[model samples]
Target: MEKITSNQNSRVKDWKRMQTKKGRVKSGQYVIEGWHIVDEAIRHRQTIKELMVVDESYLGALPVDDTTQVFIITPEIAKHISSTETPQGVFAVLDTQDYHEKIPDELQGAWLLLDNIQDPGNIGTMVRTADAAGLDGIVFGKGSADIYNPKVVRSMQGSQFHMKLFTGDILDWMAAFQNAGIKTYGTELNDQAVSYDTVKPTSQFALVMGNEGNGVDPEILEKTDQNLYIPMKGEAESLNVAVATGILLFKFVK
Candidate 1:
């Protein structure tokens, strides 16, 4: 174990930089905060470069594996690196390179696609929901929220470790899924969109969710096998993207 009491320490400075997308990309790593997330990382055997704690009190609670480097730091340094309102005093630096999985040669099984979904919470919740629904893969289209954003990571609650996540031009992927004979459905609220109930759930499918305000891109909708919408039956004009995704995901799962 190592001790770091100063906020000016080089490692602490690097950890602080991880809060931004550019920094994460440059370093090829991201910070995972709190015990729950760290536990999940350990469970998944993620390539954790290091474990950092603000106090020695947490030492006993760390993973039994002696191979991981653990560092004790001052509370001030922890506060400086933590993104939450209240610091958890525990965190891990995980290599982003380790999480980059190869896209399957064939796109099959249930999948979820996000097109320019900007909200971090919505993105994270959707990922968690997809994992719960046993979706095979998730694709984040261009302009979507960064998967490693602190808020998104916290909301995912470590479910990202359990699912396959990819990033690319979702429109291109749609064509690939279609070529493989996978049914791709996009959510839209226009008259051309049919009620979700009209479509029967299948073992192999792809659901495309769009930006919160604009809905699915018109062009993408046109390319889908079916444009589907949930019957609101309420005064509210729309559903939060995450909630709507949950409903559609479970529908397909059932």
Candidate 2:
């Protein structure tokens, strides 16, 4: 292990470069700060380019393990590598999972799909909920938030490692699921839509959610086998996407 005292170290610069979307895009890597996230990513056998820490104090804070390429730096240098306000004194540059690993073959066995959902927090929360409910995977529509975005990564609290994710066209995904005999359901606030609990799901299936204000797109609804709705018997006309997901996920499991 090599310790670096200079804040201008090239490794620090490279680590800091991963902060932006373009850098992540160009380098095919993302920054994961905090000992826990680093530990979890490593535990999941995620490729780690560098395990960075401020000093041995950070090394002492976290349990030592089979971490390769450990690098030490000054507190300011560590802060330079992280976007968070309070630097956790540790960070790592992790390789992004490829398209195949992100999208599983059996992605529909309790699926949660996002349809042009914009908010990263909402998307991340739904992924967390889907993981907790023992769902198989999550599929993000073409216009939905990026699952690999840093904000989403933080909000999910490491659910990213536990659950499978797909970030492609929902219609294409629906076709694949349908061809494989998996039923697909989408949420709608229309008169003709069936109440969510009316039909018992018998096999692998997809549960789709839509945009915050617009709801599921009609084109997507046309492709779905069932249109389901969450009955809002109270004064509130609608629910936040994450809250709605939590409620619906409970129903899906119950």
Candidate 3:
């Protein structure tokens, strides 16, 4: 393991560039921190270009074996590499293409769709919930948040590596999935929108979420096979996008 002490070091500079989306894309690499996510990457056989360890605490805790290319750095250096408030004591520059997930065989069981939902934290939490609820992959449209964002990865708690994730235009995917006899549903707050629990979802279906403020777009809503709403009895008009997603996802997931 080579020691990285200077912030001016080329590797340190590259890690800092990963703080932005363009940099991640330009280099085809992103930063993955913490033990859980890295372990998940190894378990999934994802390509890890470099592992940066900070100090003795992690040095004792992390399993040492086949770190083909590794680097050692101090906690201060780790902090410089981290994006979070409290540094996780380790960081890595991972090849994004190597970490992309394969489309699951069970694309029909329960699918979660995001239609232009752009919040990184919300996207991550929703993906985490969908994984926890045993839902199928999440399909992202053009305007949706990038799942490769560092914050999204942290918010997902390594669930990102476990679930099937697809990024591209959603219209074609939706059309194809529906054509295959899989029912597709979107959430809308309306008179015609029945309570989520009241509706009986098919074994194979897609649950669609929309933009945080505007809700589902009119075009996609028009195309969906069904529309449902989460019933709110309290004074609050609606739930936070993430919370609402959790409630609605758990219903059809089981």
Leading candidate by lDDT: 1
Q: Per model, state how many residue pairs clash.
A: 0, 0, 0
Look at candidate 2 and give me any clashing residue pairs: none
Each model's Cα RMSD = 1.5, 2.6, 2.4
Full candidate order by lDDT, most accurate first: 1, 3, 2
Residue 130, candidate 1: Cα error in Å is 0.4
TM-score of each candidate structure, all chains considered together: 0.96, 0.87, 0.91
After superposing candidate 1, which stretches have Cα over 4 Å from the reference? 98-103
Q: Which digits, one per residue and each the tens of the lDDT, describe model 1 over residues 1-254?
A: 89998888899999999999989999989999999999899889887888999887887777736777899988888889998888889999988754334457777799999999999999999999999999988988888988899988998999888987888888788888989999999999889989998878788999999999998899899999999999989899999999999989888875
Ten-residue stretch with the least lDDT total in model 1 = 97-106
lDDT of 3 by residue, 112-164 (tens): 88888888899889889988888867887767888788888888877866776
Clash pairs of candidate 3? none
Give Cα distance to truth, residue 88, candidate 1, Å.
Answer: 1.1
